[model samples]
Target: MKTATKINTRLVVFAKAPQAGKAKTRLIPALGAAGAATLARHMLGRTLDIALSAAVGPVELCMSPTPDDAAWLGIAIDSAVQLSDQGQGDLGQRMACAVQRVTQLEPVLLIGTDCPGLTPALLQQAAEQLGAHDVVMLPASDGGYVLLGLKSPCPEIFSAMPWSTAAVAEISLQRMKALGLRVWVGPMQHDIDEPADLDHLPPELMNL
Candidate 1:
């Protein structure tokens, strides 16, 4: 079978509505419920900005609780960025669905809104790496991953895994290896998920 060349790439941002007591719940102890949700909103906007700045290709915001949720209202998302509902499932299942749906059009680089270290340049590098490798991953300091890019569909990488755990990246990589996929590991980045991780957050966001 002939493999399709990756000519165009899309950045899929998986985010949840910034609802208090539900968004950024891990940080609630240190920042309070409202504060955590406020920070979540900030991170979401920052992530969107990074994706748009990369300008590699179309950017899609895969939202949870549906796009019509009140939490998404008043946010100034660019008209060019498409918004889609993340259908029901666990984290792994939702991600697998997104990758399969978006890759039908072109290659997709999936990311989340929790990682402040995800920059436009880093996204561009991942896109470039995907042109040659079967997969590209940006590892998080917490042992999870901040970004994953694929030139083709690979659902096995996102199935039956422990979500929100330190073993996420390791398990995912092992799955990729078992499937004989070439993977490019990117720089180690940290995501804001706990009180300890607050130190890594931007000063402006820290105030929230």
Candidate 2:
């Protein structure tokens, strides 16, 4: 069989400002709201550094409403590309729309800027895997996904599904199966969504 050629993957990082009270609200009790947001800012910075360093193609920073917000929180974003929210709908709709928008021109990888375990090598691996699969998912320990790469746009994965719950990954997989698309599974990782999630975070990060 002929090996598939590499396609330039656009890496889209979804991130938010690390506001003291607005960020990481779930972890506030254990870490204090300011501490929680500080940690969130740290992780977001690390993730962005990795993405910037490891990116093999275009790096798009899909950020919260305004550049000023990211600026105030010290979240370094690529200013060249204008940022936009995933919209008013749930997470799934935003992801579906993002993939659709990018897949129109090139293969795309949409990732959350919260998975500390993610690195350039892993992002590269996700990009390479997309050659063989229509959808590539890096499962998060919280029963969700950290990274999602798409060779072809598929909206069904994001429509009518529970968002921010343990069912996310399963529902996505089921959607892929139903569509008969070849799905690729990357290494299982974790996203910091709750107080319990702190244990898996980097030690230095845990301190904040």
TM-score of each: 0.94, 0.90
lDDT of 2 by residue, 1-208 (tens): 5344466888888877788888889989999988988887888778777877775578877766555554455555555444565555667777788888889899998988778899899888888878877888899988899999997778888888877889989988988999999888988998888888887888777565
**Runs off by more than 4 Å, candidate 1:** 1-7
lDDT of 1 at 199: 89
Q: Report the C-alpha displacement of residue 142, candidate 1, in angstroms.
A: 1.1
Per-residue error (Å), model 2, residue 61: 1.4
What TM-score would candidate 1 get against the native? 0.94
Tens-place lDDT digits, model 1, residues 67-132: 888878877677888999999989989988988988888889999999998889899888888888
lDDT of each: 0.89, 0.80
Kindly report which residue pairs in candidate 2 clash with one another.
none
lDDT of prediction 2:
0.80
TM-score of 2: 0.90
